[model samples]
Target chain A: MTEKAESPAARTSFFYLAIILVTLILSVIALSLGVTALQGGDASAGSYALVGFIGLALSAYMLLQTQRRPSRVTFEMPQVITTILCQKCGFKNIRDFQRGDYVFKEAEPCPKCNEKMMIASIYREVKEKEKERLS
Target chain B: MMLFVAFIFYGQRIQMYIMIREVESRLARLKFIRDEGRKMAISTIKEIGKPQEDPTERVDRFLEYIAIAPESMDPAGVVWKLEHVLDVRDIRFKDEVRLMAPEADEAQLNNLENTLEAALALNIIYKVIRHFYLLGKKTLSLYIIMQLQMVLPLIMREAEAFASALKAFATGQPIGDGAGALVAAKLMHGHEKRRIAQDIVVATVPLEGRTAHVLKSEGPGGNVGKPGDGIRRIIEETEGKIAAIVMVDAALKLEGEKPGDVAEGVGVAIGGPGIDQFKIEESVLKYKIPVNAVIVKEDIGDAVSPMRKEIFDAADTVIQRIKRLILERTKAGDSVIIAGIGNTIGIGQ
Candidate 1:
């Protein structure tokens, strides 16, 4: 079998970043050159100024395109929450889920009644993000 | 002029090449995810199971393990054949998990088995995608490549869901599929329990002046027990005298639908390779009993990943609906079977 590559997210290509960086650098150089040429009354000031504006526009477009695309699939772990219900007082306490937590497990004492609270439910909150178009 | 001529003559070829390139990139992503899933499984087995030596080889082998489906040429008794195949597969899987994680308890064994299963699922997806990707490249078939590319997004989503399930299973966290099992656990919490079927348990609970026999997959592990067989047993043991059967489970929701939305239908709401569903269907047919279904809606991703708050809260709504179904369909002192059909991971009975 052929060697599989690393996750693209982790290995964000320097190639694209390089292009953006070079464009911004060139834009700066062109703008400075245009300014120097105009201050010295150089004959090619208009062409220099035009080149600078085009480079700046190209860099801005690239930056926006990169930002607009959905971020790489990091696949971060979700935050699971545990809900503990006190049977006596009906007081509910919400907290971050611990490793050993399970549904219906008798857990910590309730602050309200000092009675042991039962872990009523343990689940993560999921945001249903729209999927990218595959059609 | 020569370049223009080439473009005109080979436009389709060029497009195919571009498409192949795109597929290659996604295939790489799939491979990475599959590898990560395997690594997580191995680490979890090591952490929880505490096996003696390095389990890298055994874990890799387990990931590649496959279940052969029984021959379907003879349609008669196919369900029983399939059930036998599944039973053997489950036994073999459990034995392998036990060997790998010798120190793990029964619940932990089930959870570890679930972790491996999730990893195996991811592995299969990666391999299948790669197979088609390579076949398309070799034959240079546009349709084959296009079909694979089209379904790749859904495939990726499912793969991601299974990947998340590894952690959920390893930690014994309840998943959305457990919504049904959670309901059963809630109903049978303080009631007397008895074994109804393989890895299934039942408790007799009195509800609204009716005798309700509520059952679910024996859990606090990740097993989805044979609820179908359990129902058949209930019917036989009770001599088909039950008034009605109410089945509760998590149903897959379409896009734009609310996750926790509850829907009512008529049937045994067990989702699997159809072994359980077939049994329930047969039992219902034989007894001529009306089977009602109450489902909690969730997306495919939500089904396997850790149970979401909405899906969790839907448990109560489902119970209430089940109560309503019982009250309206049957009278006081009547017997009813409430089957909570799902994986009972973190939800205990």
Candidate 2:
């Protein structure tokens, strides 16, 4: 089954948009109250205005920054099973499995020969080769 | 002040996260050990039991037998009889377990033949006397020879003891008094326990329409009816004294997990109705008997042939637990029930 991947930054941007929009409306309400209270005393009105400005600024910054960074980062062709063959003992190993599979994410030594293979590099080489052939 | 408070909360969150991570890792390791244990147990059971000989090798054995027995005689049949029947098979039987005495003169042999005839006439024939000619100062002593009279029963007794011990260890039950009657009582305790669970009566439902041949056909427990019914019968036969029946079956290990992993789960309803265990448990609850189950897990392939060491070791654990529980629950005359639930294939029920 295929799934459309959503980036973490995209997911965060939506979250911040909702927060900033609510914060902006709350600041407008605070400003209206401050103006109405200015008739009684200017000191309380000035403090309210300062607080509203800080709230709006913080919300805007949070919204923009969340959109800037990616929400999720995933490698290309994650579905492929990559195996690194060792020259010395002729060992073949599956380095990575599909999601919803076993959690063998740590570095593993070949049980038979105690030889280690860098699965990430093997995947990288395969990707490079595929790219070269495509070009 | 706000920053300090936030830092404190953050630290607390970090601690919680670390604790959860530790727990998850430990749970993973425990699961792995259980799975690996199951695999080893199965391999060991198969290894200890006699290995099946190849068919061609069996045929060669048959040929050897034919060479000794000739056309008319059956080796086991003839060899099981008088030691000196003057048949070609005696030469082959010599290599086997039954051996003729070197000292028997013609007169003693004649007397033995007469006695054998008399033993057969009185319906007091035994396999040992038929195979070997007994010769001694008195025929009475020879009749009670240890090999002929005691060894077979001893082997059977040992097998039963091993099975009983396995059950007791697996279930955490105490081995009862060493008295023969008590042993029999303990064995019956398991049967009686299964009887108390009311769901056992359901086993009789399927037998209402099925023929005897159909019921006796080769299948689970040599019964052709639905397995749920069989479980029900097991419960019924013991009378509503059993609380819950826990069938311990070996499940196969996943490729990732090491072999002999002990996987424990409420198995799906086998031989029909979704969870027959629930039915049995419900029946027990209806009768106010609290029901619970413990499955000594192994892989499916190795369930029948769990290794002797693993079985014995696990059985030890089972027996200890059972003994503690029974001692706690039982009084002087209280009937405690325990069952050695397994597919009694090679186990020699």
Candidate 3:
């Protein structure tokens, strides 16, 4: 019988739980200190306890937000394009490239001239603006 | 006094807990990445094992494999292995091209093979780096992620340049990186042009009172002709009479530097596997030659992608700088070699 490995999310959730526990304990200690300071008539000590309590509460809120959020990673893949031009009619067409396609190879016959269409260029679309600006 | 001490203790405890949670989150992210990398490696190996029925299909299969393959092996050993794989792929591509077009001449076939190899190599290197980069990101390795991020723009630019280079080779169009060759062609116009070696061209251009040997990679194919070989041969041919050797090439600009900025320096300015730079250095040392380097600066994003308008415009400035260096460093009636070092894809002579 093999034991299953814990996912990163699950592991992170456990850490978050631990953080919440610690924060709760700290908050309780701060509130109890504030109550004892008030009973002893020491306002300055009570204020310090209030500060500690607020700090822990803020920390707890941040930890809870992080725990509730999902981690996402995003990336973009660049596009590769092939351009074909007709030698006789000067007609041009752009299409996605197939593997093993080299430059200057003859493609299907030109529709207008009935002449061979050649792979004039095989280039990647590097610029995003070119797509919007040219089209 | 009691309440004050308790408050301080709780405050410290809360801070410690926060730090602990942060570290735990980072470690978890790293583990996630390691798991993802392992999965990708397994998938890639399985893809490589699939059988192809035809030569073209085999080429496609190999090309696709290289394009998506993850870099799971040790970094130190991967470079040599990648080079060998690229070499084998080049030979296979050449053989396939020959079979497809039996009528193509030796020169044409050689050009095609060189262009294809450079393009494929560029693509494979980019993919491999990206694979590791993704792994780093997944693993939540801040150091690895940061380092890869800094160089990612440069790598992407190189990939785009190589792609354009392939198009230039296919269509016989001049590309931007061929600024060196273009400058050489302009200076040596109407002069006796000679082919010193494979993919290297040389011609004599007369300056104000001296003669300079204008050397560049053979263009307008996807070629970064052997500038080191061209320089060494010219030095030998002139019997060490060469007064100075000036190299011009595109360089990656620092974050604050403007694109197309020209800077001058000493020694070889060529970039790559350091093979060509090493050759140039050896020859220069042997003859005790004064070497000058002129670099046109561009952002990493612009350097390897298709030549931008600014980079193209900077060529005039680069030419001026090269001429200025030669005039300043060497005297009249002396012989010099001006070598333009880069992939001469589109920009023509």
Query: Top TM-score: which candidate number?
Result: 1
lDDT of 2 at A112: 69
lDDT of 1 by residue, A29-134 (tens): 8889989999999988787777778878988887776566443445567889988999999999999887678888898898988999899889887664776464
Please write out the lDDT profile of model 3 over residues B1-349, one tens digit for every residue. 5545876878655554444344334344333333332232223222322223323443344345342222646676554555456456556766755654455454445545544454455546545665665576567555555555456555555554554344334433444454455556556655777999657888888886778998877654456766777888998899889899888888877766666677889989888666478678989899899998888876554544445545656667877887788788889999999888776654334
Give the C-alpha miss distance for residue A37 in model 3, angstroms: 26
lDDT of 2 at B170: 24
Model 2 chain B poorest 10 in a row by lDDT = B211-220
The DockQ figures for the candidates are 0.30, 0.01, 0.08
TM-score, model 2, chain B versus true chain B: 0.29
Which residues of candidate 2, in runs, are more than 4 Å off? Answer: A1-135, B1-275, B304-308, B329-332
Stronger candidate by DockQ (2 vs 3): 3
Q: Assess chain B of each prediction and give its TM-score.
A: 0.97, 0.29, 0.66
Task: Please write out the lDDT profile of model 3 over residues A21-48, one tens digit for every residue.
Answer: 7767777777778888878888766675
Q: For each of the candidates, what fraction of the native contacts does it recover?
A: 0.59, 0.00, 0.04
How does the DockQ of candidate 1 come out?
A: 0.30
Task: For model 3 chain A, give the 10-residue run with minimal summed lDDT.
Answer: A1-10
lDDT of 2 at A16: 46
